[model samples]
Target: MTLLAFLLGLALGIGFWLWQRQRLQRQLKQMLGVLQTDASSTAMSVVSRLRQEIAQANEHRSQLEERLQTWRRLLEVAPLGYLQVDEENRLLCCNDQARHLLQIDRWEPRQLRLLLELVRSYELDQLIEQTRHQQKPTIQEWVFHPPCLDGEAMGEVRSLTLRASSWPLPHGHVGVFLENRQPLIELAQSRNQWFSDLAHELRTPLTSIRLVAEALQGRLENPARRWVEQLLHETNRLINLIQNWLELSNLEKNPSKSLTYQSLELRSLIQSAWQTLEPLAQQKQMCLAYVGPDTLWIRADEARLTQVFLNLFDNSIKHSHRQGTIRVEVTAREAQVLDSEGTVDSPPFSNASDQPDSDASPSLIQIDMIDTGSGFADSDLPHVFKRLYRGDPSRQKSQGTSEPFTLVGSSGSGLGLSIIQQIIQAHGGTVQARNHPETGGAWLQIKLPDHKNLS
Candidate 1:
């Protein structure tokens, strides 16, 4: 019985050990399955994140392309010509208007070439170079002569005026906007010519009427004579207006053509003008106080300059208060100096100490004429030199109902200031009108380029 019990115990022990070993093996297999599932989930997550990032990147690229195309479309249809060039001065892109203005017949999108090779425009090239070098904006206007092509006549020169405004871009690139100004210029010239022709045609009829009126002046009596006298006065005024308009037309056609320049003592010339207008000045009880070097000289057309002075003095006399003074100050300066200062550069009413140093300058002469009265109406200041611009009725006060300042009266032509401007400009000089800060009245300043002495 003892031996049987021992063998049974050993068998049971061996079975128990085998059962434990199988259980451990099953646990190990389950752990490995769990690990593999976790690894696969992590890998799938990584791939999905990468794909989403790629899609976002593509959307951003499309947006950028859309914006670029939109800008290109807008620029293509713009009225002004737009041109772009790269750092190497190569033509990058241009609109149709640009191509037309520059006369560029060939353009290839895939190829880039120097601007000079496509369009031979020195002015355009220079403007681009200047903007690039300065790294800023620049402007230039020039007449462009397109190259004569295959069968065009060389003698029949064709030209157009072009105004270019350039702006610098990143990396030494430049963009230029071109405007063709020839059409506007031609239109203005045509209008001026039409008016000039009308003025010419009216002259003959006006003269005949004037002759008839003068003949009837002696035969009429009392109130009838007075009516004829008024008619004659109006007729004379019309004739004067016609003559002035014709003269202005001629001056505008070619500003320098009629000028006969000669060096004349400025003081004597001004004195002579004052003498001629002395009667008018005395009538208004106004006097001119000339202050400058007695021997100062200038090269100008004596007759035209006299007209300018006469018109200016006449206007001053008409606007000035009774017993008021018109002060004339002369100074010599470099052209640059005149370019900076204005007509009313002096102190209020002036002081001897504040006078400009009159030491002679080589390039220019400045004349300032200031009157003592109410200055220009604020509304009338800018239009003072414009054609047919009239002053406000309040400012155009006259002596004894003569209405001296009016071009012809409430029905005036208002060409006096315009004539003065043309005469000055024709002599290569500039004139500015302003209310004088010193005298508190109308001020006229003139700057003439010196031509030196000539025989």
Candidate 2:
């Protein structure tokens, strides 16, 4: 009975053991399947996210390219030339206008080569270098001779005046804009030449007419005599105008050639000019008062210097009110200090002498001639020095008054101030017009380089 009981327990125990083993194996298989499914899904999710990101990156790249193409199209059609150079100064990109202006035939887009190798322009190279060095916008103008596209010598072609504005870009790159100003330059030069020729041609005929008018001056009586005198007067006036035009033209053509340098006392010159115009001043009850060092010396052309003050005084006498006082103030200033004020690009006059030289005298004789007359109109100040520019009516009669200026020559030839400017520039100096602050009148300021000064 004991043996039978033991066998029964063993059987039960073995059966339980076998069942437990199967259960454990099924659980292990279930967990392994769950892990495999999770790992596969995670991997697939990561790959899908990567693919979406790649697609977005491609779309962005395409958008950027489209925008770049649009900008290039706009720049291509622009009138002014535009070009870019890399940090190495290698020609990067340029528009059609730039190609033509620079005569760049051997290059195309995406090609990089030294700018010096592509275009032979020292001025252009210098401008690029300056922009890079200063890291600021810079402007320069130079005469550029384009290379012969037909393989002929470049020297055979006419040059163009090119103005370039350069600005630095990121990473040492530079962009430049170019303008072709040759046409404007040519037009101005031609106009000046035509006027100069016409002035020359009229000189001979005018002298003959003056001679005939003078010959008839002695043979008329009463109204006829007055008419003849008037004819002579008008003829003289025309002759004067012609002479002045010729003089101004000559001065412009060769300013230095028109001068004869001489040392003279500045005070004496002003006094002489005042004396010459004293009769005219007397008619208007005007007085000349000079305030400065009594004696000052400068090197200048005597005749031209005399003409400057004569015109200034004549202008004052013509416009000054009754009992007006014309004041002359003189002072000496250093060239460096005065030059700091800068100069105009299109000043009243232009000449090589107008540029200051290191060897030039450090002294400048500044003369301020102020008159108690109607000052220049705000609109006419800039154009006053232009030849034959009409004067303001207020110049003939002061404002807030009814009296007319009757002392002077006929409404003036309009060449007076123009001649004055030429004379000043020819002496390596400057002249300007403005309303005097203290005098409340037309102010003429002139500076002449002085070889010697008191202070």
TM-score of each: 0.78, 0.69
Question: Cα miss at 170, model 2 (Å)?
Answer: 6.4
lDDT of 2 by residue, 1-455 (tens): 89999999999999999999999999999999999999999999999999999999999999999999999998899999999998889999999999988888889899989999899999999899989989999999999987676755655778889999999999999999999998999897788789778878887987898788787777766888788788878878877887777788789889988988877877899999899989988887889987766556677788889888887887777776778999887765554665544432223212333434433354666677888877666667777788887655655424533223222223367777788888889888888888766656788788766645322
Off by over 4 Å in 1: 1-50, 87-89, 106-141, 149-152, 334-361, 394-412, 453-455
Alpha carbon lDDT of residue 391, candidate 1?
72
Specify the highest-lDDT model's number: 1
Residue 443 CA error for candidate 1 (Å)? 2.7
Each prediction's Cα lDDT score? 0.80, 0.79
Model 1: clashing residue pairs?
A: 349-438
Candidate 1, number of clashes: 1
Residue 213, model 2, lDDT = 72
For model 2, state the Cα shift of residue 412 in Å: 2.2
Among the numbered candidates, top TM-score falls to 1
